[model samples]
Target chain A: MAGIQKNISPTHIDILKEVGNIGAGNAATALAQLINKKITMRVPEVNIMSFDEIIDVVGGPENMVAGIYLRFMGGIDGNILFIIPYRNTLNLLDIIFGEKKRDLFCEFDPIERSALAEIGNILAGSYLSAISSLTKMLLKPSVPALAIDMAGAILSVPLTYYGHVGDTALLIDTVFEEGENLIKGHFFLIPDVDGYDNLFLALGGV
Target chain B: MDVVKVGMADLKIVKNPQIITTLGLGSCVGVVLYDPEKKLAGLAHIMLPDSNNSKDNTNKAKFADTAIPYMIDLMLKKGAKKERLISKIAGGAQMFDFKGKSDIMKIGVRNIKAVKENLHKFNINIVAEDVGGNYGRTIEFNTNTGKLTIRSLGKGTKEI
Candidate 1:
């Protein structure tokens, strides 16, 4: 395994944080609109972490989460994941389906699953468009794939891609909130290995 | 009993009453090797199927091809007999799927195949496995009983 390069400059982290800020801001807004509630977010966190450390950010590998995955289709290639805790998933479903009716115990119905996927699509679309405008690059997002599983298992997909190069992942984490509840959703932007170079080059890096 | 944690692209060995574990295994596969007589076990969280494609293959525990041998060598050093070794594996999950995705999206399948092939090369018998699904899993190996317990989100837990 290649040692994780601790070479990401502070400037690069700042730029990535800015990118995350704009993208997640748009996503939070779209979510807020869908639920007809006020949404707030913490300042986006941009950092490079090993796969293990990344798992810790979401409450460890065994913790259950609902993850939304989208592959980037143009100019840049990578995976974008929006993760929400199982409890938060239920909360979002409740808001979308308007209940007391949706049971958290049972499996999500097909309609509920579709609703979740649509929500993921909307958020990813908005986020990508914001970054597209910022970098003057056309970014297309694939239809979202939703997985409800242990955080480690859900993360294995992208980690394997990065494993061919290095074991570290440069990620942008944006935390979302709804009123006092702290909805506990995060958007993780993981650019592919080569996609990092492309991202920096497009962002005025030498 | 002490518990040793094996992170992604990592491996560990433990003895009787102790446990070795790896968490959040989506496309990654976890291979556990146990020697019943010695009461010793080794676990690896293999990230990719092959190390030849990697620029640096120094981390022997990161790929199925390399990790199996590395693990066996460690087990031997810990008094585990190669002849008595048996394996149990878990956690090669697809996680998500979409139409028109490239073959690389099937990394979980590739990883499982690679692990099995490598174990075969080492002549280790695979006694049990819980793999190949669209969900993630966390696995633990109990060195005492050689039980591999698999845990998944909302799917409950099972032991093999």
Candidate 2:
């Protein structure tokens, strides 16, 4: 397998950033509608980095987090991850269920877990749909999987998929915020090594 | 004592009075080989089961098959005796539950199996193991004491 790192150029990065922007914009709008709160998203940052660096970007190896993972296929195959810190997860749960019953370290009930998964499903669907419409590529996302654990552990699952081909991953990252209540979350779009060519090609990159 | 951090798909060797660590191992396995008599240890955070599966095998520490033999050679060069080497392993967790039977979902199990097979190839005894759960782990291997400290969120900390 050829390394994606050798072929990535500044133009490729710009295209990915644009993808993140459109995708995250749609996701933010979907989230706002879900919670009925005004959500703002930062301009997405596209980075090609090692697996360790990607973990650090989310927080750290041991940092407690709630992660939603999904795999997308069709014109392009890749993984999309949504990460929120523990406190932010609590705040999000509070808003979604309209209650503050769960503590910081408490286990989530079956309904709470399903709620989290549905949120992931919506966010991933919106994000991928935006990209699909923009590039005219058919993209289908798998059923969302939710895991509340260490950032390193959760990210390692996706990193292993990329590990077979290369050490570095191209990450399109976007952060979402909901004002002073501090409902911040990070969204990462990681396309596989072989998928890069198809992605850049679909975007009309030479 | 200094703590040497091993990044993902990386490996490190430390002598007495030092600690070697790898963080947040989800479906990845952290393999620790220690020579208690020599007070030396090596830690490798391996991401995949085999190097032959990938065309890019340049990163030896990234796969279980390549990494174990590489660490063994390094430890031997540093005066660690092969006969005294024992293994302590942790990590290799599912992390998330996926309903489908995709190969990716079984990576943790595959990683653990590959690790055990590699260690066995080197004739190293696996003395202790805490693996195959749906949680992430941060592992620190202390060379001086030949102990592996595994810490997981909400799972409590334990040493073996």
Candidate 3:
């Protein structure tokens, strides 16, 4: 195992970025298939960042967002978060369930919330599977949990794990776009400290 | 009129009329210390309870065990008397729920306890706090009046 006390090396970062690119690319394709639309995604932004800096990555800590949270239960431990702007969430829900009797944009009923979770599950699962194939590591994802709240609050939940180890966290950030920018969203993969060595070694990057 | 922003695992000290703020404190504790006579205040948005086991020691302000003492020392250096200091805190919320409780899920409670323990170590009295729920909070502290205001989505603003 690599030294946990040491900062990430340049080579480690490069390898992780490549992994992110492959994973996010697969996830984006999966999303396009689910919605039956041409979805585009930007290159993944992979870096080791502080908790504070991450708040700014997805707009800001106070920005209201809809997040789908899932835990990686096997192989490597980590958290996968799918964050979409509240407005984008409404738009996506419209596509999933179509226009209906929903009167509010901020609040989501149970069914709408479930739809969002399902979408998140599909996308995150796709990303994980791609990474698993590349690394030859067995990976399993837990059920998804949804939250519609300030980005800070939602992010902090998973961040607690990293906080105990160090102030810096490795974030693989990817942006997804659908239908000429009708929908925009972010995906974050935050692996635990130990998981980093396990993953990199499994991928033969170490 | 200057509002200094404190980031997670960060701390800041200010005097008179200056406000210090931290946002998006879900399951994290925001500790605000104020000296009424000097009108000096310090805010520490600490992310975790202890740094005793962490291999990385670069960020002292990121943990409750280290941040409190660091902020107090800075405040005293800025001419604020420790004997006159009082504390007001906010933002220790359990953002999600699970059927079987895990230690990670109880981070908010652990953070609150850690903050209080550190305060007690310095003999600082905690005057007010708004904590322990399933929500996120943004907090601001006024050095002039020593007021801490808390804000959250859906819930209205609250003052501690």
Candidate 4:
């Protein structure tokens, strides 16, 4: 936490904010195509947070959730998390994929796996694109890892919430709209302060 | 003919004139009990490995741990002989990457284990099975023929 406050945060957060907005749109489009329906997706509200503050803000222990986890590595390294409720996953899927007939012995198998992958690809791709277009910073992404679990189990890694110099945590809140379902996910950017310092120190005569 | 559909944490038993099926089983396990002699077949679309985790302790057909025993008992009560019972199992997928490390979170693997253990406890042998991996499976059982088919989009259909 101390290392985070030692570094400046403004410039980094401004860039992520713009990228997350575009990412939401891309995710919406992918889901639309996957389900073969015309879906309207709304841009999400973006926020930034360190590891600790996020666990507290994303609702308490009572919440049961299922979501997609995608990690960004290469030029930029961070994780993307989605929190979808069980009832909502069905409602949203029903609109996009249509309802499963009770008498039909609904075969919803193959599609579920692909649906998760497609969302990850689109949202993560759009994010990298947005960051490059806005800040001219080149980024690379990896294949996403999707799973369903409690909010606490998903954010397994330890995060430094409060920085040494700054007491506040940065958070980004965003929403995605499609059919009647509204999907929300949080984007957190953690600068390995030492990594950034190494970049600049190596470049400059320090 | 009626097609009986089972939902999450639900179970149904039907014979003759009806066929039973369940879809999109990720970590969930689907257990089928058939009595060829009596022409009675019961299928359980179970969510977890064991019903012990559920709040309802009395209902044995709810979890992977209890559903098999429960189905066999129901069949026995309906004039189905104990020696005539046969078992089949499917579903339990790895869904996510675990950094190539072993973890207890793999529901697909755990489901398979629970079903195998419980079946042994009840002395029911699995006649067929399709389980373990990252892919989701849809299982269909034809009561008329006592045959079950497992389907995955990425892979061709196979009878297990």
Best by lDDT, which number?
2
Q: After superposition, how far is residue B138 of candidate 2 from its true place, in Å?
A: 0.7
User: Considering DockQ, where higher is better, how would the candidates rank from best to worst?
Assistant: 2, 1, 3, 4
Q: Per-residue lDDT tens digits of candidate 4, residues A1-206?
A: 34344544555444445555565555556556765656564444434443324545555222334556654544444445565654555555666576654322233465865675566667667655664454445656556666554343344321211221232334444555455444434433333334334323322313
| Candidate ranking (TM-score, best to worst) | 2, 1, 3, 4
On the 0 to 100 scale, the lDDT of residue B153 in model 3 is: 86
Candidate 3 CAPRI grade: medium
Query: Which residue pairs in model 1 clash with each other?
Result: A1-B59, A152-B24, A153-B24, A153-B25, A153-B26
The parts of candidate 3 lying over 4 Å away from their true place are: A1-11, A100-105
lDDT of 1: 0.86
Whichever of 3 and 4 has more DockQ, that candidate is: 3
Backbone clashes, candidate 1:
5
| DockQ-superior candidate, 1 or 2 | 2
Rank candidates by lDDT, best first: 2, 1, 3, 4
For model 2, the stretches where C-alpha displacement exceeds 4 angstroms are none
**Interface RMSD (Å), every candidate:** 1.8, 1.4, 2.8, 14.5
How do the residues B76-115 of candidate 2 rate in per-residue lDDT, one tens digit apiece? 9999999999999998899889988889989999999999
Local lDDT at B16 for model 2 = 85
Q: Model 4: DockQ against the native?
A: 0.04
Better of 1 and 4 by DockQ: 1
